[model samples]
Target: MTTADALYTVNVTINGQPHEVKVPARRTLVDLLRYDLDMTGTKETCSVGVCGACTVLIDGEIAASCITLAVQADGANITTIEGVANGEALHPLQQSFIDHGGFQCGICTSGQIVAAKSLLDSNPSPTEDEVKEWMMGNLCRCTGYYQIMESILKASK
Candidate 1:
């Protein structure tokens, strides 16, 4: 078989649901989620990890899905934006974002929320400086940092 034909099997638990999928060796975790599994909440912008637009939780830590290989996520527990909310109720961050106007244009909202969730999960009550430092990697073209910061701070309370 050619190099392009090499495939790997990844058994991942996404959004608390288990899934086993066959993917090419080169398949990125973002692509696997978006195409193979139809989970598109994770966006791919910079493609590089610098943008943080493709951030997701892998084993409870924030990860850049666009740069992570699907095979690297084998046997891992992943959480995407789609998995953040309860059955019908929105996650606190989701609701806070809406209430606080944390997003504009909405391209970077998912990543911002995911990263903010990670911060809150680790530090339930972080200072403003801490929140700013943690979210520096997530860039919003709409310049909505103030509202985004407000959302995280509000959700922390």
Candidate 2:
């Protein structure tokens, strides 16, 4: 097989669980998560990295999985939206989103929450401007931004 079709073995710890799989070298992390691993929470909206729909945490840093190759994630720790909550219990950010009406169509909800979680992890007491600036990268077409800000701010308290 040509290099384009070559499959490489990948081992990654996702959500604290170890996983091993062989995938095409060109397979994106998002595809590996959504398709191969059946993790549909990370959406593939713009295909490119502009839209934060495929946002995930790689080694605790927020990254756009759509632009990240699966092979690049070998031996890395990945955290998808599925990893954000405990069994039958929602994360504070998730609960805040629901209570504050942070989502409308819900396409960007997962990404927004993931990104927000990352933001909170790094800056637990960020100001409103900080939250707005941090969340600017994530787009929400249906719902307004006020609710999202409220959710993050409320969750921080």
Please report the candidate that would top TM-score against the real structure: 1
Residue pairs whose backbone atoms clash in candidate 1: none
Runs in model 2 deviating more than 4 A are: 1-3
TM-scores for all candidates: the values are 0.96, 0.96
**What is the per-residue lDDT of model 2 for residues 7-56, given as tens digits with 9 covering 90 to 100?**
79999999999999899998999999988999999988998888788899
lDDT of 1 by residue, 1-157 (tens): 5687888889999999999999999999999999999988899999989988999999999999999999999999999999989989999999999999999899899999999999999999999999999999999998999999999999996
Instruction: Please state the error at residue 151 of candidate 1 in Å.
Output: 0.7
Q: Which stretches of candidate 1 lie over 4 Å from their true place?
A: 1-4
- Candidate 1 CA-lDDT value: 0.94
Q: Candidate 1 has what TM-score?
A: 0.96
TM-score of 2: 0.96
